[model samples]
Target: METKQTDIKLKTPIRCIVKLGGAAITCKNEFEKINEANLITVSSQLREAMMFGSSSGSVLEMDWSKRPGMAESLVKVDDYKEQLVLDFSSFVVIHGAGSFGHFQASTSGVHRGGLNQPLVKAGFVATRISVTSLNLEIVRALAREGIPSVAMSPFSCGWSTRERNIASADVSAVVEALDSGFVPVLHGDAVLDEALGCTILSGDVIISHLAAHLKPQFVVFLTDVFGVYDRPPAEPNAVLLREIAVREDGSWSVVNPTLEDSDKQVEISVASHDTTGGMVTKISEAAMIAKHGIDVYIVKAATEHSLTALSGKLRDKIPDDWLGTVIRHVS
Candidate 1:
């Protein structure tokens, strides 16, 4: 008998995990409203950032000609041919529901965690529909920018704890998507919980889970504001924090500590319609993820070239002091 040898293939590494904050990309206070301009602008910037990595000789291109429903799709053949020749970075994008699911979750009381009431049960179904709708819109925007993005839902691939936090997630599909040259677009969604009947899994929480498993080089959060502040921007004496350092011992401190102090909860307000905890939760989740030894950035999506800067492509374009908050572990 002859022995046969099997060859193993190396997987492509995902360079970044970009989280599009709900407040940054959509009108969070409005009901199911999406900021098309912001969405389009961010999508375009991401395209530039991904293409910048191509200069490093890693030419990962998307063959748009192979997209399904080619005839019905708005993309032109020539444009498709043009995009196929461009290089793209390996990344996974996760977006928040903003006004879409937030309003529904707030109304249904789904964010309170667990399910026993009939209204909460009904809200679970509605929340999924609302968030998935936004996911489709985001996927379309990225596709329009010549990025091949596939919409994925946390509900379909994740499970939550009794406290409604994500306990475990099957991100194999996301890894496969990245290896196959497609950006997996995921969003905050209503997932079934082992302890709770159901709950809303925020995008930030999803990013934490992804960071633990995918271990991307960078985790970027595109928010409405520039970055974390010493106090809420609405406060009279608030100041921006360019860097937040977390020690290996689990202690954290701001780079430029401010004298003006304020309430932490007051500083991190959830939208009136938002069910998910807002900035406060974001900071906590980011801190948890940072413990995993990954760099986290929170920047404004509306800022010029913000995405490119966060992608490490526009370091020369911006000052040594980046216009965003960076979370990193201290040496």
Candidate 2:
């Protein structure tokens, strides 16, 4: 018997996982209302990218449950998905629950609250309903854009934990979609489980999972700030880490250290307990994926040139300290 090699050619057009941070879609400042103008601007850029075929697919991950009148937001996402499909004819999308599940999980102190809480049943119900509503908005949005987009829930897709398992399923779906020439839109949502009960999946986790499985040329994490700042941006001389090297200990080291005596080392930290993953989780996850030889870019979504930067078309146009971090394998 002859042994045959499995020749699975990587899909074309460059498969990428574009993470739209919740903070980018929500309030930049406490006093400011939702940034509708910025939202529209970003959406237009995405539309243009799809129109010209710069991006193979896109995913919008936000926490809609926390927002007021979430039903309305869902409508917006659906409308956008629809428009994109009609206009561009190809593209994948994913969104997160803005605030729907965040509040409940936070208050209950149950990282996976909805599964077994009878007292907080009302909250759980509301969260699920709100997520569904938000999904509708994404669908409608794709319709309006003439792009065919689909909404997926954790429960529906068999996501029950915050570990690599969730990432596995998500990546499987994305790969399936790409192989069949369909765009898969995923979002952060509450998933029901009999084993761990119920848990809220974070968008960052989803992105990390995709990168690990797909091993794309690069992964792009878009946020409100220009990129990761050297200081907190409030202080003077706050610089950005242009490139990060993954260490054997699974930590990221910047070229420049913040203090003279201190090592130029930093670990991505989780944002909150309610959220499944955070910056730290993302960095760690990206580092793991990089070990297999992948590059990750953390950039500011607010920058109009973000898409161009990721596409490697405007390399000379971006500044040195653009407010983001790049993680790559040293070896």
* Clash totals for all candidate models: 0, 62
lDDT of each: 0.75, 0.55
Cα TM-score of candidate 2: 0.71
Per-residue alpha-carbon lDDT of model 2 for 86-162, expressed as tens digits? 23433445454444455555555445454556745555565566656656655544444444456666657666563
Q: What is the lDDT of residue 309 in candidate 1?
A: 54
Candidate 2 clashes: the total is 62
How much does each candidate deviate from the true structure in C-alpha RMSD?
6.4, 7.4
Position 132, candidate 2: lDDT: 66
**Residue pairs in clash, model 1:** none
The best candidate in terms of TM-score = 1
Which 10-residue window of candidate 1 scores lowest in summed lDDT?
1-10
List the candidate 1 regions with Cα displacement exceeding 4 Å: 1-10, 52-75, 78-85, 113-116, 257-266, 313-321
